[model samples]
Target: MKMDYVSSGIGKTDFLQLRKLYPLFVFSRVSWENRLDHLYIEYEFWTGKNSRNALFFRPSLKVYGRPIEKGSAEWLDPFLFQLGLIELISYWKATCSPEILIQAGSLAASQIKWWQKLYLKGLGEFFFRNGIERDYPGILHIECDSAKQFRPVEIFSLQGNLIPVGGGKDSFLTLEWMKEEKENNLCFLLNPIKAQWDTLRYFSYPLDQVIVVERQIDSLLLGLNKKGFLNGHTPFSALLAFLGTMLMALYKIKNYVASQESSANHPTVPSESINHQYSKSYEFERDFQKFLADSLCPSFSYFSLLRPLSEIQIARLISEIPGALSVFQSCNKNRHCGGWCGHCAKCLFSFLIFRPFVEAQKISGIFGSDLLEKQSLFSLFLSLCGKAEQRPFECLGTEEESLAAASLLWHKAKATGKKPPVLIEKLFSQYPHLLMTRNAIQATYDLVNTEHSLPKKFLSLLQKNVIKKALFDD
Candidate 1:
């Protein structure tokens, strides 16, 4: 009998049923080989003991402009093993199995707790969306059968910075800030897309200087998703953290500079911790740094370069860099199409953030239309402003930031003696109290959250280029 899982929706019953059917998910093995110019990795998993149905995934990475050296297996093995641990989450969510058996490597009690916290918090949105209530200390159990414990390697002689580019304004700004030392920095990209490449080209970075990792999902997992098995968002940035660490070790890079912003800390669901961008949050940044220091090399610096700035600040900075305005993109839905869809929450939020800084004509030209005039995106607008039940489950700024951007645009329109757009008019008419004053909006631009992991050198760089010049000078 074919189950109508979609119509019924996956709930506690479905969660329990799948767990009972597939009692155990095993992290069976991790194998990697350094080929001529690329390093190939394969991970194996099983639904249950003695089950013939096994899953295999192959993800390869290449570091150009350098020789491929198979680093010490002692350190490399653990890195690959940990990478498998994160990769398994995508497949494990299919059944939400009660226990995960680790046969490939071992973890200490503290390490087990660390992973549990990561999985639970990382999958918080997944549980909330599926209407599944998971309790702590018993939500998911991890058992390690192997006797081997991987220790941190004493690594030295690593130099240069590695920046992960996402083809967005944030990364573009990072590239701009690091332009002085661009030769020492390498752009890291996973599953290269046209937008990512476009951002690199706009920055005048050659392809040979980029580190590209090609990740492939197992077909069986997709088949399960199609068969109506439970599935939702996984912690992708968490996977990137591990993969970035592997590349750092493989290439002897000192820094893994990401472009995640402070706004990622806000939860999608207000008053709850179910953030779609949990892996990109500052909490994760701090936790991952500690884990790396404890389990890997302490000197391997991993931090977001734009951690201290807000989305509005990033947008303001990008607005000043006119060259990036055309090449960089943030709309996830329309990136492959090479333009803004202008309908999704991401597109709408981006438009709102940039509206105050860029001229109306230029904004319209970039997005192909005035997103503010689109009445269809009103609900998303309300959600982003915190008027709706929850913010759209996307990487967006806080509700206050959205309100500030909208308010700033509103005041600008009124001062210019021009009428506000449809959405803007609707916003003030319906919720007048939501409007913010110009001074209040400017406060967001000047504000800098003190909580960040940026080292002194990078912090000084941010202060000089962004804080002192970009935000205040304007």
Candidate 2:
């Protein structure tokens, strides 16, 4: 928990040491350093930690040997370190037998850790052999901060704060909150393969000021004989802040903010993400916020602007906010296509939660179309119904909210006399696990009033109610 850089130089700040400790690193660099802003961020990685030697599943990793610069060393260093984990672990599974990687944080992170070895092994086999590569490249190209391509973090930090932007409802909500809160120290992120920038022109013009985390990590896997799918839901929230710390310290920024929702604090699915929201929960905001203060910077503070809200709550808020919707991005299947691949959980959940507020034109723009087919909605339905190793907790929503959205969609479907969402139909036909989820969602959601958004503070207060609902529902 406590790391002393001087005594544990190699343990705390040595890149070469970490690389040697883990090893599969092939390439690395500082992709964007906005000198004017004093933000320096490195795009780097780590080797395999081999925590799975005792199990049949092994996770291989790939990452850069450095950091990406957006602000200062204070802001950039830990940000890069955090980025390295998410970037490398994808390759880690591709190279090893790490099916269901427990990323120590993230919804998926929590679920995988609790699953049996047999389940993990099964997922590993299905993934590496099949290699289901999915990426939502809708936000990577927005113009970067107004500075040279490779500005140092020392400079970027002085320019502003590094904000790890998410292309989703949560972030869209945070942007408005932060803007309304009058915090100008902001820097945005554009991940590898995202198209959020092209769409930004549809909304605000100031987006060019955002700092991008251009990732080319896929190049490293070019020669590896093995392959595994990329894992999602790691503690990228905290990681980005650590990076902000490094870059800000090196360059001079003093604060960082993330868009993590308050609901993230509870398990993604009860018993699934229980203790691990720290990877993305408000718990991380609280803990890491203090960690940064005690061990690191006194002036530097890291917390989620959306920490008090739930994913559903944020989605609802984003619907009410105007320009924010135009620039937001969070689809995994199609980033460049200018449409939400209704199948991915992000699109599915967003469409469902906001169905009550946003109109067809607005919804169409969000997903690239007004027409959400039954199949798209069903994909999410199936996930929540329990199709894979984990349910789409992000999609599951609070019981009351979940039921509310389900009811709206349900009513709309019945009125049109359309077939039930695939998963629902399957359950009606007596599908095993499939039926259980349908019944659960129907019963569980009945009490949720999934209508309208709540103030961030109010949403936080409702978390206890959500937990009670999640546990009591079944």
Candidate 3:
């Protein structure tokens, strides 16, 4: 379809009216089906005039042996707009569409504010990476049918905790905590990969315990990217947040616990709002909770279980969980087959953080090779440590965490009168300031982050069940 609106650098006389001419995209329809005990969700999006696209479920959703009443789940009727809005942003931002027309469902005044914040701040990394300047077209003009509400389920009567897993150590640690309530702790995943399956199986969770959905993207959007329509990263976690709510309602689950951590708050670029993990940050979690409370069911709750902890702290906690050494995988590049390429930023960061908590041989064995011995990874390590020109755009812990891990490893080796790993020694030699004493090294391991949305009960659970005797208590 030809773009009817003026674009930047076009020197057109209609620049001022660009917002009006720009196509208004609407999330038009949401259809579903239950075949062979599987639920399938289909979405339709329209972009001004006659242009429209559709997305379907690649693999039908499975909620094994669970009772999901069609009428009760269909109450998701009103919230479909919330789910659609999240899905629409990915395609809308692709064209950098100036206006979004909502024809499918309603958005409250607070909903408008929440979405604007998500689109602008959540896409911070996308715009900066694509060289798109920050000029947000005003607040979304949300046009919907009417505000609708359905019968609310009793909040106290809800049964289980829906823990979303990504085959990472953070989720694994969350799993360990939720195990006390494991019978009532259900796992939620979108498009489960081999790594996810392996991790779940290693934890002895039966196939029936996990709920899986296959989210299909519109192929037309992929084609546009090939044809040079603007494209970059979309806030994927935001999409998951909405999809998670739908599944929670459908399956009659209450708590939506993701594994986002405190380290995600750091900006990817210095002095800028471009954080790769913006959707996973504590700010987004807090905003999402408020929006859920205001606009959705009173029975539902959403928050990250690992919000108060750091990557290093989580790594230390994961070390205590059995089978963690071999089953967990955090390398996004090789997540499909559960293999670590051992060259990417995620792999390097995981290697550094794990070094402080686990034995050298065990850590190397889990990764299938010693990452520290590979001199070729030095540059990648530097990128993670903030020595390079840019922070790796991948999801990683803060640079301070990386430096602290290196410092601890070096000092620990010195205290034991043993030579440190090649990477640790090289890091210490190059940046002498990273060389710390045993006392300072211990301080780095204690990550007490106060900026989290975890409730008092959840915080108490972590302290009594996981933290007190886990890391520093030793």
Candidate 4:
């Protein structure tokens, strides 16, 4: 089943008692899958010694019918332990349980501070959304008992990259840029969807190159959520980062490349730090890299390939790629429909961001309608353009980026002596100064803030392989 399946559950008061009674959350054992073609993982979480919750997370990889390598038990143990920690972190978000107890797994003293920062800062938006005040002391605490000392694992040196596809344009751009290395590259997804499959098919790789992992959240958490537990957003990108670390130890893959763009660095709110994409931000990425090097295996590298590119640039680059126009779907609400719902912030933002690059008809074709033409969506357009006070809590570019795209398109239409699109015309009328006047749009497009942890070795290769050479024009 798809991960986004929503079920109707009894809504009750926020279960404040559960948090008060069970102040500690524990990371327990991992049930490793030794099956022929499955990479199954089951993790256990505990509120106390007796109260427990367990969930199954599996990403099935066929490995092209190859036999399992021998003598992996020793090195794989620590990786599995860390994977269990990552899984436990997400489950802990359900209740915001103050103390995280790792009875067996160990982290360095400094590493503990790093994990604490991730949990608190990453959950800032969650706290804000649930109206849960975080002004109390001892709210985010972690206890780690060293089970084993850290030891360096031998690098896999497989001459391959492991790319996690998220069924979005950003990942598609990353996949396209890395196409030359496709012979040595592998793709994986947690809970494979049609858009992901369509992207994989577009690349025409051997079926064995793709790995699918099904991540199942425990029903107990959902039941508790239904019972009105403190339910809100968790930093899923951080969870993905941990999963990548686990896969590196298991498969010995050299690089874990994700597709988080630089735009994610912007907060969901203008002046505050509450961001829905906190895990995808450069701060979290840098911190994760440091923790990985100091605590986990240094032989493996994790980084985002699209770190330097803005959302506008990414949208433009994706437009140049073939086949993704119809296959790609980033709308979280319209997943069952297999494309844009035309009603949510994601759909509106994506439609607006791509207008300057992709043809109007083709963009409309992808979404089944011209989103700019929808008058009912004017309020959402206002919010996306920063005219409204509340920014939509979704993975969108900054207000300036959206406004710049709208302005650039308006000028482009005027240059051709054609009337602007409905949304563009409306936005131009209200915020005329927001439009890019006298090459200002070019400046924003060229402003690639250098706040990323991309390795120096891959920089030149990324510049050369990107769909648009202008990606490096800055």
Please tell me which predicted candidate would have the highest lDDT against the true structure: 1
Order of all candidates by TM-score, from best down to worst?
1, 4, 3, 2
Q: What's the C-alpha lDDT at position 94 in model 4?
A: 67
Each prediction's Cα lDDT score? Answer: 0.83, 0.44, 0.72, 0.73
TM-score leader: 1
The per-candidate count of clashes, in order, stands at 0, 90, 0, 3
Residue 360, candidate 1: alpha-carbon lDDT:
86
Give the number of colliding residue pairs in candidate 3.
0
Per-model TM values vs. the true structure: 0.94, 0.55, 0.87, 0.90
Backbone clashes in model 3, listed as residue pairs: none
Per-residue CA lDDT of candidate 1, range 1-474, in tens?
A: 112265324343367677776788888788887777777788888875345754443433443435543454447887888888899888888888888999999998988899988999899898888877746335599999898889988777888898888888888899999999898988888887888999888878976678888888877777777767888999999999999898888778899999999999988875666889999999999999999999888889999999999998888888888667888888988867788998899999999998888888999999999999988889989998988887788888999999988887788778879998889889999999999877777787788989998899999999988753322223
Model 1 CA deviation exceeding 4 Å by range? 1-4, 7-13, 52-65, 69-74, 468-474
On residues 120-157, what C-alpha lDDT tens digit does candidate 4 reach at each position?
Answer: 77878877776665554677788875576555566555
What is the C-alpha local distance difference test score of candidate 4?
Answer: 0.73
Per-residue C-alpha lDDT of model 2 across residues 1-474, encoded as one tens digit per residue: 111122232234222332234433322323544444333333433235553422122222222222334333334433443344344444444333222222222222222232222122223322222333222121011111212121222232344444555555555554454453334444555453344554333334264445454433445444332221223233444445555565456435555666665445555435322323445645455555555554445566565555544555555556656665656667756765555676666676666677645665667666665434564465455454344455553423543454445444554555668764444444335543222233444453333333323335434544432432231222
Output the better candidate (2/3) by lDDT.
3
**Clashing pairs in model 4, backbone N/Cα/C closer than 3 A:** 58-214, 59-213, 60-212
Which residues of candidate 4, in runs, are more than 4 Å off? 1-16, 48-67, 145-152, 156-158, 465-474
